[model samples]
Target: MEEQRVNELKDPSASKKDELLKRRKKQVGGAQGDSSGTASQGEISPEEAAEQAAVMRSQIHLFWGNMLFERSQIECKLGLHDWKKNLDVAVERFKLAGASEADISTVLKNHCSNEEAAAGHEKKVEDPISNVVDKGDN
Candidate 1:
């Protein structure tokens, strides 16, 4: 059995298999090596990093707000008859529009309960001056 094992170890196919495994290891290790190379490179300045972060935050906020507005519009058109399904559709649309899962949840949590509520909120957002004037003693 020992002699048979030694013979198998010397087989050309076995050597080829070993070569393939080593090549795979190198490919896997190369990915880590590239990341380390990037780490060794210079980092971004603090101000630049802060600016980038601010821009990203603004973009996310804008995306969330737009999704909310769109959701409200959809609710207004579809009415309150299958609200759960409508909210699901709105969430899916938000995902397709590049909203993160957290943003989707936040939007849902802050969403209006029915079409009437959605219309009221939409009107308030779309016409703040009108809302104030209407509330005033004309």
Candidate 2:
């Protein structure tokens, strides 16, 4: 499965790439140095090129993936903030757009059910000072 393959992927770290580079260098053994692990000489073997290309591609993929993850996370947070800030305006606009009250209520109930449930299930805050005072009195 695609998810399984994704789960198998190791975190992109400098050490893993460094290890690959070290191995490539050992394989090259006195050849023209290529930091990307490709041989700098005129005649590059296809296998060597493919190997180096895969490494470079993976590094690039991880870099972009991290950037995307951070950007998307921030975007989602901002969206949630805007949603909470403008919910009343949004609902009023929906009414002005000729949406039925029943439909609006249904949508709001579904969207805000999580908050209602969370509020209902909130635990009572314990007072440590009260407990300590009671203990001293006892």
Candidate 3:
């Protein structure tokens, strides 16, 4: 009996195909959290919802990039490598970015490196921000 079940699973023409199709139908139909296995009465179609999600994902990516760049600049200015302490300062500068504290911490922990922070400190000490503008005046 077990061997027969295995063979049926391997055969696309078997009743297993119908079962799989029914499961998929249930999942897609109830995606809107309706109890009746149908979309909410006024909910948008699946394709339109997926498109909006994609757009939101891209926007979030851009915002994350901009926030990281600004944080790097501030770290260079402060000549510090301790990003955990400076996160609040960075968050203040990026107040309009709309990122949550948890998201900012996750991004920093994943992407920010000690080497980059060290490089920022080195650049700040060697050149200094004031000297750069002064040099531009010449």
Query: Compared with the true structure, what per-residue lDDT tens digits does model 2 show for residues 56-136?
Result: 665665445434434444444556544443445545544443345665564455454245565655532346666778999
Ranking by TM-score: 2, 1, 3
TM-score of 3: 0.30
Query: Top lDDT: which candidate number?
Result: 1
Residue range 1-138, candidate 3, lDDT tens digits: 877644432231334345545655676667747666555445555765665555455445445555655676567567777644455455443343344555455445544455577788888887877798899999
Model 1 TM-score (2 dp) = 0.30
Please give, for residues 1-138, the per-residue lDDT of candidate 1 as tens digits. 777544432231344345545655665566557855653223544764665565455445445545555656566565756556656665654555445566556566566555467788888787987778888956
- Model 1: colliding residue pairs: none
Residue-pair clash count for candidate 2: 0
My TM-score estimates for the predictions, one after another, are 0.30, 0.38, 0.30
lDDT of 3: 0.54
Compute the lDDT for candidate 1: 0.55
How far does residue 86 in candidate 3 sit from its true spot (Å)? 12
Ten residues in sequence with the least summed lDDT for candidate 2: 4-13
lDDT of each: 0.55, 0.52, 0.54
Ranking by lDDT: 1, 3, 2
Error of 2 at 115 (Å): 15
After superposing candidate 1 on the true structure, give the runs of residues whose Cα lies further than 4 Å from its correct spot.
Answer: 1-42, 81-138
